[model samples]
Target: MLEHGAAPPSSEPPTAPDPVPSPGFVGRLARRKPVELLVAESGRGEGGAALRRTLTMWQLTTISIGATLGTGIFVVLGEATPLAGPAVAVSFVLAGLTALFSALSYAELAGSIPVSGSSYSYAYATMGELVAWICGWCLVLEYGISVAAVAVGWGEYLDELLHGTFGVTLPGAVSAPLGEGGYVNLPALAVIVLAMVFLMGGAKESARINTAMVAIKIMTLLLFCGIGFFGIQAGNYAPLAPLGAGGVSAAAATLFFSYIGFDAASTAGEEARNPQRDLPRAIMLSLLIVTVLYCVVALVAVGAMPWRDFAGTDAALARIMEDVTGLGLWSVVLAAGAVVAIASVVFAVLYGQTRILFAMSRDGLVPPVFAKVNERTGTPRANTVLVAAFCGLLAATVPLGELANATSIGTLFAFALVNVAVVLLRYTRPGMNRTFRVRFFPLTPLLGFGFCLWMMASLPAVTWAVFSAWMAAGLALYFLYGVRHSRLAVAVAVAGRD
Candidate 1:
């Protein structure tokens, strides 16, 4: 459940308004307070006390990589290419830039807060309870739906691998759960269940699995790029921006979904070693690596096949390779690799959703049970089970395209909020310490917000309607339950007695 409420009003009304502070001063103020909060929180011995700082920089980098480079690259390119032609490459760069701006803002907050729940926690401590609740609500959509959608895509790729490798085909009903032929997606459900078991084992084990999967996926993509580069044709570059600037921008907006995983790194701040230094490095490094890979993959994919042919195809990459290489054997290998890649993505994302819920529960923003860690496993067992069940249902029932638009829209909203929070925190608290600060202060964060809004506007009208309804439900929950239950509210009451 989500929590919500307005911050309590001051005991006395102000006689005069304070002057608006300069952006730089505001930035410094915002930067310092979160660090103080984190230090205080760390000393207090809360939940996650048993969790060790076991994640190395390499492991952290891979977690970011594994989380970000999943179905979006394999699935979205086919849809985006038709929108922008070869200029889809340009769209990738544009989306990367938008993400980079927001990523910097996140680094600053993660450094200061060093807490979980990513932007949700940052908003609570800096912006006020109401805004924090909204941010957390937006994140629920971003993390939860993304896991479902990606898991469903994973199921499709798994089926592709089976058909390609074994020459044995499962019936449509058995292969696809609630798909066009009305069969339930058993593979997706199975994958989610398996991932849940691993996640319940604790952070160290999960990080190890993520690191290995990231390596495998990265190698597979590099192999594809290496092979496809040979097949590149100059003619593919003709009519580069076939749909013009509008189409390119639309594609860029969609591509923003591919960049969603970088912030997952920030969500692990409490578990990070020297979070103030490592979190920023991890976020920026992961973004840089993925941006380069995305560009290469888009270039190779377009050069190998006609952009028009990719639209609406689920197995777009394998088809392109098959046609280009005329080697069924190589396509089989590629399909198998994609299945592993997408599965890893689903695992990483679902883990992130569970963790975010855990953080909220600890703050009394949601049900307390959500924060309960399994003593033996050191994992948030209750939250993991709940999240996995919901994600599994969606993966089995919903169509991928139906959910993709909503996922992108939700994420853009969260990203925009995070950027704005960075600016707000800067103005609200100035004396705090910060290990990392976003460059150019207000200007960078402002541009990041503007870009996210522009992308949000590009979503279809139906997506907007769905987002509005979800937000309304969240607001209702906040007012009905969360505001009354919040720890911050209780703290205020105690202070009044003193």
Candidate 2:
């Protein structure tokens, strides 16, 4: 007979203890070093057959600024200003702060472990094989789709310049991509191809072209900002926070995506003269410069036009200039600047993405062929071609807004992960030689993490869904191929034997 309160046990089997340790904030970070080992496995060492270290600190900073300053300021500002009003200025500040946290973390990690793969390599070194694979997948979406989205933006501005300067308009079928009643985005594809050619030639050539384009873009933006400030009317400031705090925060999250390219500076670690010192300097410097530029641009944009009128407008900066100057001349100049700027962004982003793939392939996380550098050019020719083809297809076909949102979600997710990695690394490897550290350690990273999470939450529900789906696919691939092929996993097994 059973005791009064006693009952028969249910048929469910006893639960198994968890296989992986519960990743507390600290415990999770302890995993960063192993991730670094994974990154090192793919290297031919710093002085190997890869492209020689040729980039100066100034070039790296310029590439970062050039990559980040394009579509976000010139185009997204108009869209976000309407949503947040004059508070868009505050939004830029918030986004910059958030970016600063991550940039600081990147500087420290990059200094200790200067490599070319960016966050994916960082994740591999700090997290594990699986996390590294997922990070790489996320980066593909971030950089790949961004290249395409930026290219489409270039097409719009190119059409505007052509029409304004010569009274000639390319047919919609030729100027726009399909579904917009266009046959192909000829200019967009052409830009991608040109970038590929430049990349395949060599890093020095690419850097020279990028430097020139960056100078042009910066000059145009400064000119616009200078002129627009004087044209500012106080009436535009009516209802400063039109959408209120919530809207401003939301806009900051979206606009933060505009700041994504600054990390590209760190990706050129292997090519920096003194990566440990210069990488951090370049990363922080570029972020600082771009933030100031963004703040000024946002201020002038809101001052020049009412927030309500900017919604759903494609090229708001050009539109604002046309409104203020009334001369088609300024519009043409702005349009030309937009075209050059967005094209430069595509070149920088695509180059970064291909290099990441090259590193991963060299590590055996992906096919080895991607790591194959052309001995003559010292570029990952196969990877560049494949990436360019995919980007071109997307630019020639897909809608820009969908691609932009997807890219933003991927970027924010990668950023959030990096901040978390920073906090984890602090306790796990306190004695690791860090050249540049985030000022307040746990607090700064925590703030950065919170801001990133906030931005992620602000994204459209559909964007989240898409991101989730992409991650799921990435996990499946990791299990199916990356896990078995990973160089780090093999190293771990060998260490166990020894």
Candidate 3:
């Protein structure tokens, strides 16, 4: 029966390879995946492996706190307070409420969906691929440009810190970008590298660092309040509304930058230990903490000094502390605190960008390579490096103000879209399990959308032009590649035939 040790064959047949599906016209373009599918997709690491869920509520909250509490405070107060006068405190409260509306909507979506990509994923789950693309594109601007902007701000504060403490400074040859009078922004680029290294260690370690930094930021504000309160002249607040209601509105819009990262907590939904319960709680808690801190600081700042005096000054809080106590040392320490706060913002924002890109990559909207997570680090190493490189280049090249306006517009646009997604999802998937439903439903989401739109409309025309160009470019890319190769497009094509 057998010659030369040959054995008898089994009665099994060889398997055929799987076929690649085609893309259908209308259906493929508008394809929407179920939320459950997205939930599963969010957890898959490199090559569809699983990611470690290690972030707790505290970590998530700190992520929001760390990102929201930024150098914007150190800068915006000096600039915005002059416009709103002592009523800048009220402006801070109003601005915070605007973020709160969207924050509530975000809390609901993040809890229910528990995916990355923030509003982009929310739009995909609720709206369609096209809207989701727009949201994702805007997020690329929001997260990417904001990092560069914050880095520039950080660079300035770093200069202030070094000059104040060490009596030394970085030379312009290494500190400024081309158009701004320097070869490159060394400090900004260096900070990006530092953040990249920390993130490479993975999310848990970053959280630990962020928590400590957030604490310092809050404590520094507390110290300012504790000292500045004793100097409150009460008379300083006599003309609280000197700039009138218009001024309050204007200042509120300006102050929105300080409240930018409430939704940052939701971006980490996948890594959150309790996505539903903790994500919502963290979002709300961060908003509450930041709002309280801003209001108290604004009140104390204006009360300690005439609101007019705050205008046109750098390190306003530190200067105020010096004015209150006549101690040059406290001013330096406060300036140093500002440097720390802005660095946390950079870290948190960069963290948010990588996760969003990871989500987009998982959907086949971008290169799948970005979806690859390091098995050892439990992080997306390639994606993190790419983001760092992109941001570092921008930080080293672009000036701060040019980078800042576009971010606010992009952020507000995404917030409005997210608010819309929540409303639409409530109607589309009534039966979907929601761990945290927005309290007032339609009223809240609609108002959130309106508020975001109002602020967006208030931004400069050049900002809109830049954003429009970016979106147009995104549309071109989507049509050229995103449509033909999208996983959902393939699914729709296969399902239609079936």
Candidate 4:
């Protein structure tokens, strides 16, 4: 049998024009790019420029934390609290566990494959080109739309901060979209552009700034916990699961969005100083830190404020701070912190999106412009600028209510593919060296895939319909462009001629 990612051995005479039959259409679609080729091609860019590998494990961890820990904690509790009451804390744990299973699979693959494409590359090396393209398409939605979504959320916190600090706020015409009862959302566009500027400076610099912002947000949450702890009433815990197990499950799906950015580290595989070792450690460590912080903050927020009162709350954490302190001082502080927190999410997630496109472009699955690197900064400057423009425009003009759920479903789909790819790689390349392995092998990855499906099922049917339409569009694009331009297909064709 032919080895995965390798061409078939030839048996024809050397004089034959074609030594072997070229891979059939199905075979071309399923062709796995050799891992060695992928690694060898890593960091390569037009004009001999390459991505700089300056990120340490700590920076990688902070990147993931900065990406995953911000927007959800600052805003999602209000949405989930009414669903599960005080048991929202349990909902967070349940969501974290679901993320844990996928994180394990991600860690294993990131350690072994260690490419900038994240799950997309893992799928390419195990599943096939078609699956890889689908995974990559899903990532585009996950990171791109999520960045816009987070940017839109940033505008709300900015309004809160400005209103608290100064005597006034930006007019709704400037702060919100037309669909949301205003003109363009200038604040959202401004925040996306700000994050783009940081990313354009390069990954290491972006990571440094992101780490600082992450520290501030962490301290902010800790401060909230400390102040809010004093107001905890055991009475709030009376009707723990008021809405029952179904509510907990529903809330868990909502909370799952909080876990989305934990895989941001995996997207930095090409930039990591020691990808095989550091990537896995960063992924797992970041998940651990984010989960602990989430569970702790959820408990404190629920204990400090009754779940029934959480229904209409927007910034639940800041409101809780006000209730606990009997002063707007801490509330303003939390709002200010949320602004910084959401900005970090925009920065980190945008960085991941650009890198994913970089990988896809290198493989000829996307336009070459995305793979071009700036010689001075060692960054994909044009790519960053383009992605920023798109996301910023989306944030400025779109009413992203149901669209936000599309981001979650897209992420869940990509994560499920990652879990499946990890298992396939284990079977196809058992001898491949891995710095980290998913414990219990098949069981671990199987559970990861199952959990992804469960959370996806919990989403609204409208989200599924949206996902299906997006996928259909992707398939059409792949057939029209990606399949014809794919480097793997070209390589296979050339090998057959030899």
Q: Which 10-residue span in candidate 1 carries the lowest summed lDDT?
A: 1-10
1-498 per-residue lDDT for model 2 (tens digits): 001111234233344212232345334222233534433443342124575578888988887887888877777876677668888989999878878887877777777667777888777665755676777888889888888888887877887888989988988887787678888888888889999998888777898999899889988999888878877989888788987898888787767777889988867776677777788888888999999988888889888888788888877777778778887688888888888888899889988888778777776778877777776777778889999999999888776665567877788777777787777667755656576777766877787788778777777888888888878887787667766676645544565567
Q: Which ten residues in a row have the lowest lDDT in candidate 4?
A: 1-10
Kindly provide the TM-score of model 1 when superposed on the true structure, using C-alpha atoms.
Answer: 0.88
lDDT of every model, 2 decimals: 0.76, 0.76, 0.85, 0.88
- When 1 and 3 are scored with lDDT, the better candidate is 3
Give all candidate RMSDs, comma-separated: 7.2, 10.6, 10.3, 5.0
What tens digits encode model 3's per-residue C-alpha lDDT throughout 9-48? 4232333112223345654555566676788677786585
lDDT of 2 at 410: 85
Candidate 4 global lDDT: 0.88
Winner on TM-score (1 vs 3): 3
What residue pairs are clashing in model 2?
29-424, 32-126, 35-124, 35-125, 35-126, 36-125, 173-182
Best by lDDT: 4
User: For every model shown, what is its TM-score relative to the native structure?
Assistant: 0.88, 0.88, 0.93, 0.94
Error of 2 at 470 (Å): 1.4
Instruction: Output the lDDT of residue 306, model 3.
Output: 88
Q: For residue 264, what is the lDDT in candidate 3?
A: 90
> Using TM-score as the measure, what is the rank order of every candidate, best first?
4, 3, 1, 2
